[model samples]
Target: MKLKIINSDKILYEEDVFYLKAPGLNGYFQILENHTSFISILKKGNLKFKNKKKIKKNLNIEKGILKVNKNFIIILL
Candidate 1:
Protein backbone atom coordinates (compact mmCIF):
# COMPACT_ATOMS: atom_id res chain seq x y z
CA MET A 1 0.00 0.00 0.00
CA LYS A 2 1.13 3.53 -0.70
CA LEU A 3 1.05 5.93 2.24
CA LYS A 4 1.49 9.67 2.28
CA ILE A 5 1.61 12.04 5.20
CA ILE A 6 1.04 15.69 4.53
CA ASN A 7 0.76 18.88 6.47
CA SER A 8 -0.09 22.44 5.50
CA ASP A 9 3.48 23.26 4.60
CA LYS A 10 4.83 20.16 2.88
CA ILE A 11 4.73 16.44 2.36
CA LEU A 12 6.15 14.66 5.36
CA TYR A 13 6.26 11.17 3.98
CA GLU A 14 5.49 9.17 0.85
CA GLU A 15 6.25 5.49 0.59
CA ASP A 16 5.00 1.98 0.17
CA VAL A 17 3.83 0.41 3.41
CA PHE A 18 3.25 -3.19 4.29
CA TYR A 19 1.40 -2.56 7.53
CA LEU A 20 0.09 0.39 9.53
CA LYS A 21 -1.27 1.11 12.98
CA ALA A 22 -3.03 4.33 13.83
CA PRO A 23 -4.75 6.09 16.68
CA GLY A 24 -8.31 6.56 15.62
CA LEU A 25 -10.63 8.81 17.55
CA ASN A 26 -12.39 5.85 19.09
CA GLY A 27 -9.43 3.57 19.32
CA TYR A 28 -6.39 2.15 17.59
CA PHE A 29 -6.68 0.46 14.22
CA GLN A 30 -4.51 -1.39 11.78
CA ILE A 31 -4.27 -1.40 7.98
CA LEU A 32 -2.63 -3.63 5.44
CA GLU A 33 -2.46 -4.12 1.72
CA ASN A 34 -5.86 -4.31 -0.03
CA HIS A 35 -7.62 -2.90 3.01
CA THR A 36 -11.05 -1.43 2.50
CA SER A 37 -11.42 2.26 1.77
CA PHE A 38 -12.47 4.52 4.63
CA ILE A 39 -11.75 7.68 6.57
CA SER A 40 -11.33 8.49 10.22
CA ILE A 41 -10.35 11.10 12.73
CA LEU A 42 -7.04 10.72 14.43
CA LYS A 43 -6.11 11.56 17.98
CA LYS A 44 -2.86 12.38 19.72
CA GLY A 45 -1.02 9.11 20.03
CA ASN A 46 1.59 6.87 18.58
CA LEU A 47 1.23 5.84 14.96
CA LYS A 48 3.17 2.91 13.66
CA PHE A 49 3.79 1.53 10.18
CA LYS A 50 6.06 -0.92 8.44
CA ASN A 51 7.43 -0.36 4.97
CA LYS A 52 8.00 -2.62 1.98
CA LYS A 53 11.60 -2.98 3.06
CA LYS A 54 10.39 -4.22 6.46
CA ILE A 55 11.56 -1.10 8.20
CA LYS A 56 9.34 0.06 11.02
CA LYS A 57 8.70 3.65 11.96
CA ASN A 58 6.83 5.31 14.77
CA LEU A 59 5.29 8.73 14.94
CA ASN A 60 3.61 10.68 17.67
CA ILE A 61 0.82 12.49 15.94
CA GLU A 62 -1.46 15.24 17.04
CA LYS A 63 -5.05 15.50 15.88
CA GLY A 64 -5.46 14.83 12.17
CA ILE A 65 -7.47 13.16 9.44
CA LEU A 66 -6.87 9.86 7.76
CA LYS A 67 -8.12 8.77 4.36
CA VAL A 68 -7.72 5.36 2.84
CA ASN A 69 -8.77 4.23 -0.58
CA LYS A 70 -7.66 1.35 -2.74
CA ASN A 71 -4.58 0.71 -0.70
CA PHE A 72 -3.60 4.34 -0.69
CA ILE A 73 -3.36 6.23 2.60
CA ILE A 74 -3.39 9.96 3.06
CA ILE A 75 -2.85 11.47 6.46
CA LEU A 76 -3.48 15.16 6.88
CA LEU A 77 -2.06 16.68 10.00
Candidate 2:
Protein backbone atom coordinates (compact mmCIF):
# COMPACT_ATOMS: atom_id res chain seq x y z
CA MET A 1 0.00 0.00 0.00
CA LYS A 2 1.10 3.58 -0.62
CA LEU A 3 1.78 5.41 2.63
CA LYS A 4 2.13 9.12 3.27
CA ILE A 5 2.96 10.89 6.52
CA ILE A 6 2.32 14.60 6.75
CA ASN A 7 2.33 17.46 9.19
CA SER A 8 1.16 21.07 8.97
CA ASP A 9 4.21 22.17 6.99
CA LYS A 10 5.14 19.43 4.58
CA ILE A 11 5.00 15.79 3.68
CA LEU A 12 7.18 13.62 5.81
CA TYR A 13 7.30 10.25 4.01
CA GLU A 14 5.65 8.79 0.96
CA GLU A 15 6.23 5.29 -0.35
CA ASP A 16 4.77 1.88 -0.96
CA VAL A 17 4.79 -0.31 2.09
CA PHE A 18 4.06 -3.99 2.29
CA TYR A 19 3.07 -3.86 5.95
CA LEU A 20 2.45 -1.25 8.61
CA LYS A 21 2.52 -1.42 12.41
CA ALA A 22 0.76 1.39 14.18
CA PRO A 23 -0.16 2.26 17.72
CA GLY A 24 -3.90 2.16 18.26
CA LEU A 25 -5.83 3.39 21.27
CA ASN A 26 -6.06 -0.10 22.68
CA GLY A 27 -2.90 -1.59 21.29
CA TYR A 28 -0.60 -1.89 18.30
CA PHE A 29 -2.01 -3.17 15.05
CA GLN A 30 -0.74 -4.10 11.62
CA ILE A 31 -2.04 -3.16 8.19
CA LEU A 32 -1.36 -4.77 4.85
CA GLU A 33 -2.43 -4.45 1.28
CA ASN A 34 -6.13 -4.79 0.52
CA HIS A 35 -7.04 -4.23 4.14
CA THR A 36 -10.41 -2.73 4.99
CA SER A 37 -10.73 1.02 4.94
CA PHE A 38 -10.91 2.70 8.34
CA ILE A 39 -9.63 5.41 10.65
CA SER A 40 -7.93 5.30 14.02
CA ILE A 41 -6.17 7.44 16.55
CA LEU A 42 -2.45 7.07 17.04
CA LYS A 43 -0.31 7.36 20.14
CA LYS A 44 3.32 8.17 20.75
CA GLY A 45 5.43 5.18 19.81
CA ASN A 46 7.56 3.60 17.19
CA LEU A 47 5.78 3.06 13.92
CA LYS A 48 7.26 0.46 11.60
CA PHE A 49 6.78 -0.20 7.93
CA LYS A 50 7.92 -2.77 5.42
CA ASN A 51 8.34 -1.29 1.99
CA LYS A 52 7.91 -2.78 -1.45
CA LYS A 53 11.62 -3.41 -1.45
CA LYS A 54 11.16 -5.10 1.96
CA ILE A 55 13.19 -2.48 3.77
CA LYS A 56 11.97 -1.77 7.27
CA LYS A 57 12.30 1.29 9.48
CA ASN A 58 11.04 2.48 12.84
CA LEU A 59 9.94 6.08 13.29
CA ASN A 60 8.98 7.93 16.42
CA ILE A 61 5.56 9.52 16.19
CA GLU A 62 3.50 11.75 18.42
CA LYS A 63 -0.28 11.83 18.61
CA GLY A 64 -1.86 11.56 15.19
CA ILE A 65 -4.66 10.20 13.08
CA LEU A 66 -4.43 7.32 10.62
CA LYS A 67 -6.59 6.97 7.58
CA VAL A 68 -6.54 3.89 5.43
CA ASN A 69 -8.34 3.25 2.21
CA LYS A 70 -8.06 0.98 -0.80
CA ASN A 71 -5.03 2.61 -2.35
CA PHE A 72 -3.25 4.67 0.23
CA ILE A 73 -2.57 5.63 3.82
CA ILE A 74 -2.52 9.13 5.24
CA ILE A 75 -0.99 9.66 8.66
CA LEU A 76 -1.47 13.15 10.04
CA LEU A 77 0.65 14.13 13.02
lDDT of 2 by residue, 1-77 (tens): 89999999999999999999999889999998899999999998889998888899888998899999996999999
Over 1-77, each residue of candidate 1 has an lDDT whose tens digit, in order, gives 89999999999999999988999988999998898999999999988999889999998999899999998999999
For candidate 2, the lDDT comes to 0.93
Worst 10 residues of 1 by lDDT: 46-55
* Shift of residue 12 alpha carbon in model 1, Å: 0.6
> How do the predictions measure up, each by TM-score?
0.97, 0.95
Give the runs in model 2 whose Cα sits over 4 Å from its true position. none
Name model 1 segments beyond 4 Å from true: none
What lDDT does the true structure give each of the candidates? 0.94, 0.93
TM-score of structure candidate 1 = 0.97
Query: Which candidate ranks first by TM-score, i.e. highest?
Result: 1
lDDT of 1 at 49: 95
